[model samples]
Target: MSKDAFAAAALALTAAAENGSNMCLSFLNALPVTHAAISTLGAPFGSETICASDSQAARLEELQIDFGAGPCWDALRTRAPVVDADLSEPTESAWSLLREAIRDTGILSLYSFPLAIGELNVGALDLYATTRAALNLPLIARASALADLAATPVARQVIRRLPHLDTDDTNPATYSRREVHQATGMIIAQMRVNADDAQALLRAHAFTLGRPVREVAADVVARRIKFTRDDVVDRD
Candidate 1:
């Protein structure tokens, strides 16, 4: 892609940061693919399509979510891009079911990029072409960059929907305090997520409750809150 295309993508994604509905369209405008989709997979957000450039793109994401497997799932699991430049060839073992499911869909190529920030596994960005095509190194790199940019706002959009809880507020400066670090460690142990993901969970919980992140960290440190893979437990 040309520099102008990347610049356009940046602008479109910036707008998408505010209005998430435009995210897939933004990717479509920037890439060489025929369709695009943005989806959140598992935890905190659950697996669902956030947006798709067209019905075919939406169906592709829905199939992955239904079968619990696809390039998108692989992209997130490996935290790397998944590219199948020619769908006509034999499917990889990991994608057998998804390949069979999509065989009649007229898709000739597929690409997926993981959307992540720190330890938070937000979701994926998927692109597909109806006609045979390959994404060269530069295009893949640009797609990865766009996916990275999309992760934060996508996470925030999901976090904002949680029910707000009443809590004491603290200074934003306390976000970097020792207690915050300790609390993040506790969450890591509790949730089995990475340090970055643990901290993101803490910050997201604080945002949902309309409190300073430090206050939430303090609660975790005090054992007033406990995180589990399935839920956040209040020990109050």
Candidate 2:
């Protein structure tokens, strides 16, 4: 892709972010794929298809979430691009169930790029091609770059959906609270997740218990609440 084209794509994504438009379409218009989808996977945001160019694209994401394996999962886990250039002659056996599920979907190629901000593993942006095709190194790099640009807006969209989070608060103190930061670090150390995921976990736990996030953070800081990989334990 030319620099001009890349700039145009970025502008389109910016417009979508500002107007609440479907951002996935920007990928379809800019990339070589026929379909595209963006999703939030795992904790903090949970698993959800935020946008898809078509039903098949949405189904692909759904299948990945259901089976717990797919290019999207792999991309997010490894923080790298995953490309099954020829799905009919799959290069890897990691997503057996996903391969079977998408067999007759006329999707001959699939690509996934991890979305993240620093160490925060957000989710993935997936692209699908109905005909056997490969994204060369340059295209892969471009897609990855675009995915990086898309992560912030996608994260914002998910964060806005959290009932307990006040996105409109401009008070820096609300975000810079000492207890919250301490609790987040504790969760990161306990669960082996990124800072963003750790914070989201705190908010999620607080939301579940109908308590203020600060209170939950205080509990965690006080060692009255513990976070495990599988569950949150109240030491109190």
Candidate 3:
């Protein structure tokens, strides 16, 4: 990173700290990426979009949710950076569906950097490029540094919002999808399971119904869907 780029990144991150992760997407403009997104790993919802540079960036992030496989997913799952500078190349065999989706969108490169603090994996920073070219070592280092700087703020926001969600008289849409967290706690109470398994069950039920996790969480919160020991039964 050059001196000017480094200064700009610092200023952008300062702005993000003041507002939220929504302000962080603009930070990627200093890089070669055309579009970008920040996704946080949620308990019941798998990965939820935190912010994006634009609608196109948001849609690129959603490809993982729609198709269930992508570089972002891999990075979060394995706690490693997924660097694919050329999606059109035949070298990628892990996520064929995601590659085709990117190709269809006219994006030629994709990158994912996991946000981890020690053993805890929080989320991922995803980037897209319009041209087909590999990223050099310096560029990769800059990307990694930016991802590291942004991760803590994102993680802190999630933690700060948890208490608010657990209390009474809180809005559901205050911090993105708050119902998802409430529904996760409800599932924990109903099933007497750990957060991980409860969230997995929640996601499985959503997948079975072919609906988004937030929509299913709304049903759960409304007392419309109940999870029994052996089945997810509808109360309606």
The candidate that wins on lDDT is 2
Query: Compared with the true structure, what per-residue lDDT tens digits does model 3 show for residues 133-169?
Result: 6456687777777787666566655554442222323
Cα TM-score per model = 0.73, 0.71, 0.64
Query: In model 1, which regions exceed 4 Å deviation?
Result: 165-202, 205-214, 217-236
> Residue 200 CA error for candidate 1 (Å)?
8.2
lDDT of 1 by residue, 24-125 (tens): 888888888888998999875688898889998899889988988889988998999998888888855776868867767988888999987655577999
For each candidate, C-alpha RMSD in Å? Answer: 7.9, 7.7, 11.5
Q: How would you encode candidate 2's per-residue C-alpha lDDT over 25-52 as one tens digit per residue?
A: 8888888788899998886568889999
**Which structure among the candidates has the greatest TM-score?**
1
Each candidate: what lDDT?
A: 0.80, 0.80, 0.71
* Clashing residue pairs in candidate 3 (N, C-alpha, C atoms within 3 angstroms): none
Clashes of each: 0, 0, 0
Least accurate stretch of 10 residues (summed lDDT) in model 3? 160-169
Query: How well does candidate 2 match the true structure in TM-score terms?
Result: 0.71
lDDT of 3: 0.71
